[model samples]
Target chain A: MPTIVVDVMPKPEILDPQGKAIAGALPRLGFTGFASVRQGRRFELTVDGEVTEDVLAQARKAAEELLSNPVIEDVVNVAVLTESAQNESQSA
Target chain B: MTAQNTELPLIGDYSTAGPVLTGARIGVVTFPGTLDDRDAARAVRLAGGEAVPLWHAEPDGAAALSSLDAVIIPGGFSYGDYLRAGAIARFAPLMDAIIAAAGGTAGNDAGLGGSAAGLPVLGICNGFQILTESHLLPGSMIKNESLKFLCQDQVLRVENNATAWTREFSAGEEITVPLKNQDGQYVADEKTLDRLEGEGLVTFRYVGGNPNGSRRDIAGITNAAGNVVGLMPHPEHAVEPGFGPDSAAGMRLGTDGLGIFTSVVASIAGGAQ
Candidate 1:
């Protein structure tokens, strides 16, 4: 079964307090040279069979309507998760 | 009056006073993790209206709302506040019906007029989040700027009293109510905020300092038609005399929040006239 991956992030104009707190903690934890940090969410939706355009379109609609709030967050990415990419993400 | 001499008013006390409207059917929606439905229903009963329970997952949203004169989406951590508060609950079947009945559409400007002209709806706290998520109201709620859960007796200025939920209040009336929430800060584009102010759609403004860093100290707002209103404060908690916030009159004697419920009933009654 193939999986659809949706990535969502707080809009740049909106304040990201969680990301700000993480960024503030980096130097205290001995991690240096990082300018800032922005946290986001990634959702993996499993499909029973081959990933099709229709399925991808439905996933996109879901991403816009449910996964990400267009008011404060943006749907950054919506794509099929290839096996190689999944392994790469796991290894990384 | 002394505390001992003050008679505590029980729920449905208005029935003995020859109730204004013959039990306006007000539906209170209960989403998973909702915390204030009971309080909201009590407020309705106290205001001389019948409280009807509506489930979020009701398959026939139209059928559920057909007989309802009004609906309330009370405060709570719906869906455990996952993936942003009220984000997932926005897609519930009941919300779809609410959006339609309140003259709203998904991802559309709330100012646009729709078919249903006057089904009164009030969303409080998490309910306000769902309204924004459903686009029945504009703007979104985020974490408090202090990054802490806020619970306080908040004072609010009634900016507009013509809305269906505020008809009992006079413009600029100050009322105190309990406000408790994590994601209570309301945010929106400057244009939208300006438009809300320009249109007199702002229903409530924090009288004291901004509690959650909400833009312009906005505590509540209503839609274009004035039938739908949303606020972050828990007015339902302040409807009862002994259980409400303190006021200059006496301790726990502030029933200012009752106006919201009474106002709706009055609006319904007036609409039928």
Candidate 2:
């Protein structure tokens, strides 16, 4: 089985209050490395069969139409998960 | 004038001596998490129209909409506000039918009738979210600037009274209705906002104060053809006296929201005539 990952983020022009709240909390917790933060969503779609160009295309379509709204958010990344990367994620 | 001397008309008052005009059949859609369909139906009935129940997952979308004089997408947390406020419900089969009938694109093809006005559709609250998600209306609803789920009686000034759902209101008339939602902030690009303002498509503007940080204090808007209207407030909740918000008339006596329901019924009846 394979997996397709879709990453969506709020548009730069849009206000991200949730992200800002998280960023504020991080500084209070003594982790002062990051200046700002923006929250986003990630979706992992499991494929039953082998990943192909057609599957990737379908994932991209879903990302644009369902996973993210073009008005306030941008579909930043849509890609297939490699076997090694999947293993690494599972182990971690 | 004293309360007793005032001649304010009671809400949902219809003369029994004359024949009731229940000819217009309006459909109220119920998505999985819809909470206001019953209220919407009651508003339609009070407005002298028959209310038809519509399911979001209706297999035969065309059949569900065929006999309806108008359709209302009421407010609710459809699909439990998953992904986004209305992202999932926007793809429902019934919404596809509504999109087609509203002269909006559904799935890739141009709208059914090629931008010509079709059915009259009103989206309230969550329904407004779905309309934007479906591209029937422009812009998107994000979390409120306050980052809280607000519930209150809101004041709105009608800017465009020619829309199907606002025919009973005069331009610049102020109305009071309930507004409750988490994702109610409306946003759009500057060009789109300018065009809406320029074309007089802005149907309602927040009057007293901005409730949710909506762009330009716009509380409602209508499509170019004026057949499709979307608003953040819940008019259905204020259609009946004693159940509505307080106003100068008396406590819980405000029926300003009834005008929206009656407007559509009158529009449909007038068209038939």
Best by TM-score: 2
lDDT of 2 by residue, A44-90 (tens): 99998989889899999989888899999999999898999999999
Best by DockQ: 2
lDDT of each: 0.85, 0.87
- Candidate 2 lDDT over B1-273, as tens digits, reads 334224322111112213346688888888888888878888888888887778787777777787788999989999999999989999887787888877776732633333244788999999999999998899999999888999999999999999899999998899999999999999999999999999999999998889899999999999998999999999998988899999898998888999999999998988822
- Residue B80 miss distance in model 1 (angstroms): 1.6
Ten-residue segment with the worst summed lDDT in candidate 2 chain A? A15-24
lDDT tens digits by residue: candidate 1, B1-273: 333224321111222223444558899988788889888988898898988778787778877788889999989888898888998788776777788777777412333233446589999999999888888888998889887898889999999998999999998999999989899889998999999999999999998799888999999999998998999998999987789999888998888899999999998877731
TM-score of 2: 0.91
Runs in model 2 with CA error above 4 Å? B1-20, B107-117
Candidate 1 predicts chain B with a TM-score of: 0.89
TM-score of chain B of each: 0.89, 0.90
Chain A vs. true chain A, TM-score per model, equals 0.93, 0.97
